[model samples]
Target chain A: MAKAKLDKEKLLWMYRMMLLIRRFEERTAQMYGMQKIGGFCHLYIGQEAVGVGTVAAMKKGDYLISAYRDHGHILAMGTDPKPVMAELFGKATGVSKGKGGSMHLFDNEKGYMGGHGIVGGQIPLATGMAFAIRYKKSNQVVVCSFGEGAVHQGAFHESLNLAKLWNLPVVYLIENNRYGMGTPLERASAVWDLSQKACSYDMARATVDGMDVLQVNEAMKEAIERARQENQPTLIEARTYRFRGHSMSDPVHSHYRTKEEVEEQKERDPISSFQAYLLDKKILTKKMADTIEDEIKKEVMDAVKFAEESPLPSLESRFSDVYA
Target chain B: MAEITFREALNQAMAEEMQRDENVYLMGEEVGYYNGAYKVSQGLMEKFGASRVIDTPIAELGFAGVGIGSAMVGLRPIIEMMTFNFSILALDQIINNAAKLRYMSGGQFKIPIVFRGPGGSAHMLAAQHSQCLDPWFCNVPGLIVMTPSTPYDGKGMLKTAIRDDNPVIFIESESMYGFKGEVPEEEYLIPIGVGDIKRGGSDITLVAWNKMVHVAMEAAAILEKEDIEAEVIDPRTLKPLDEQMIVTSVEKTNRCVVIEEGWPYAGVGAEIAARISALAFDSLDAPILRVSSEDLPMPYAHNLEKEVLPSVDKVVRAAKKVLYI
Candidate 1:
């Protein structure tokens, strides 16, 4: 409760968390390229602000749920890197005991609902989580995250309608990174402004600059506050971009997007922008930032080593976790 | 104990579970004010109110997924899909999300939810809304598929499905909703993953479920008249099938015939038939016969409708085939 403001320490913590997420992703992408990690890997590089900002607004009783680009949310919510990395390595020590790699990370202890694989699959699930919070008459809210792509799924619309009708304490966030795999946002959706789509359900909705941590945090704070106080749901469309391809399997050339466009968006990088804000505000010295980077780099390296040493789940494991 | 109709018994099971636990709730298309399309959720909206006895949109997959999510947190939600045919829209949520969550999350999440509704052919409703989906879902792991024929079984099995820590598919019958039968008034629960024997004999084993259970009983009666004698078995729960009951019956009779309203190829009957063939291989006096719906969409006409679904006549014919009579 003390010093919750974006002061030097808090900003530093944010940077450290985002840095950890970024390092984990960068090396994870490299690992994927090296064939160390298997299955679909959706990097959370450009969209770190969305996870970091929104999770900051969440409390102990609050819950979080998201699509496959979920490593960042889990890490930010305080899940150990070893288990998550082990999950990536398909090892038994993983969060999902190696059965759910990349896309199905779950940490119930940390209030992280899941890293659901199917698009828009978690929307109704998250709505139900909020329903539970309200049903129990608790003050907790749920942050249900989905990509702009999920707007096409029927669950998305259905959940929104129910949440609005019931006045459940839920925050429906759309990480509009402007692309759905190979399809750009323009081609994928007729309505370019995703937040406005919520108006049809008569739900409170807005859009924010997803690359700016401050803007996203401010938006999330308002949404979370309204959800808890008024028992109303909020929909936020954070307009952002992905620094990498959709997945490791996707080639840069197969899509309609150009390298120039990607490089141009890199100029508005969230991490770099936050760093600039810190330097201007004199929140942290350049040397201190460098030390934090070194520490995070070591953590990522240690995680990679532990994952390498971790044992793979046995063939018998295919039957073990079905019950418990 | 007071006797209740199948419809009243189903209502009692849900009402009792909801009264006993704060987490139990029922939601469906017409389960609220309209008092259940088949009256299974009768007076529930009054007892539990509109919030818990929720009447949702016609979107089956959407509401079904919501029920899965609600169950994931702490509530036990029974999502009613007016009939099993309507469950097709929500199949992905039921099969993919609900059925796979517990295993997919590696024991982190439990979908203690129920997708309950009437199943099998429902008399002249035509192709799209009358065919059964038990076979499609029984194939999926992490789910307990159930079809209750008797009022007592309906009351007991539904209560069990509500309390289970995994997703359960509870099938009812539009044809048997109003059927009168004795149901225990006391709070009773039948364990899931276990089958039940409705009638017992020794000449042959006739296994069926839902409306087919009646067919099995009818076949048993016909065999009784012919002095052939048959054991009528209903594997109430489909997924964690009661192979023991089927095997034991086949051992006693040395012959078996499985009846299902689903199509002949790859129906729930096929799975039980194969298991019977394996378990009762040495004990069998004749081959295992399957009495199943013809592999086609149900027609709107009454005669075609009767012919399309597995009936008492089919069960009798199938029993003769197994007995070589």
Candidate 2:
């Protein structure tokens, strides 16, 4: 593929965003260990490129919905980290008012639809949002993201068929991290190549290296443009890896895979690789990289302090928001 | 007042709402050119265009979730399940997504959508197609369940449901589609959680809804011949039930009998019976009796199907049992 022609400022912005996610998740894991943050917390350690690249390709007013592993997506969309960290702390000032933990972050103002808990549940909802955009004659599009395991669900097949049949404006993004909890994708899926499954619906398909932010952004630009201009739906598979376990309960290297394999995968970490790319391109110097690191480290720590001091949700709030 | 069939009343409710709000649209199998599986949405495609009256593939979960997704972004969608039985395929979207999005999202999103269709035994649809699912939806916290018996209540209550800012399960009866009743030409909206007393009496209070309300009326007529006046009360909306109306009626008559078309176990009748017993224990002269469908899956044979459902004779017997005569 030809060189991505991104400017110096945009490339540096992507680097900072990826580093911020890495630091935020590291602190989140530490908080989980201290028992300050509870519930099923899934970390996005090695898959930062997919979330950052895809959100970079999107424009204002575009909507996004993702599965349980969604802290990276909302953060990539420029949501304040204080509220997100507070949400993980289950405090009243959180983005979802502490109602939704790590898996259910929602920032409606940014068009970040939700952090849905179910595997394939958000697929049809994204298709419906595209349908609404068409119904209202709006030019906006919707991006629906899910893990590779969600591809086996009925909601995935059903949604792709409707999106193609109606020519709805949507992009179905699959972040294939190679495992669904302890089970590998090869054992779970009938077809190893997930993009081939889109052929059943005759929808457009693309694949990108999830560790390379530029390649993923290039693919997303083309797919999102197709959706916005032609009202077509595309299924883009980003071959990525999650360095952490499925949740905090599971270890990084379990019986599912060996410890050496986890260490080897870390060598291709999205954040480190992107930093190398920026350095090789002469767009970022060692001094600039150190400055970005220090800024992000302070920001992550302040978020931790904000979350630690935040109050738990009031008891009366439990009954509110159940209707309307 | 204009006399119309139950189907026409429902059609008017959709058409008027669609005319009032551009965000309102209808989607389902056979809803567009097919004119709806049961013709409840007849002529909608022609009036509102295909964009508004959408016909979808036979994927209940897909279209149901699509309606909810649209509702999340400020669209009022009336999703028709070919039958309430088919809605079982989409229960996850309804129960988990639509019902929980508001609370889980901390009120950032409100799902103003409706899942409406005919429920309960209709002909010999067998065990699969024939079911009364009001209790299933009523059991959920975020959903509002409505079962209107007459054309007037059908039109008025559906309009109310469409305009309300909450997810609604509006269940209609297949057998009552052609049933005629008086409905005003002017616009009207019935508030949710209010009960209507269809008949007034002093001997016993008969509680029922949807098709069972008619059966309760028939039972009341039979009890009237024996000098035992029975008051028939229909709680139009099941979830936010009008407990005050039923409690007051039971206090006046001092006797109660609840009837329903669903199975006896955990049915809506059971909930109402429990509520009346709890709230009107001091006023009760006798224990409350419930007449419900036999605790079995609907059988295909005509005789067995009739035997499994709640009938006027069964309701009359339950009322007489409560009256101790």
Best by TM-score: 2
The digit string of per-residue lDDT tens for model 2 on B25-109 reads 9999999999999999999999999999999999999999999999999999999998999999999999999999998889999
Which pairs clash in model 2?
Answer: none
lDDT, each prediction: 0.87, 0.93
Give the Cα error of residue A156 in candidate 2, in Å. 0.5
The model with the greatest DockQ is 2
What fraction of the true interface does each of the listed models get right, in terms of native contacts kept? 0.67, 0.86
Error at B180, model 1, angstroms: 1.0
* DockQ list for all candidates: 0.69, 0.89
Off by over 4 Å in 1: A1-5
For model 2, report DockQ.
0.89
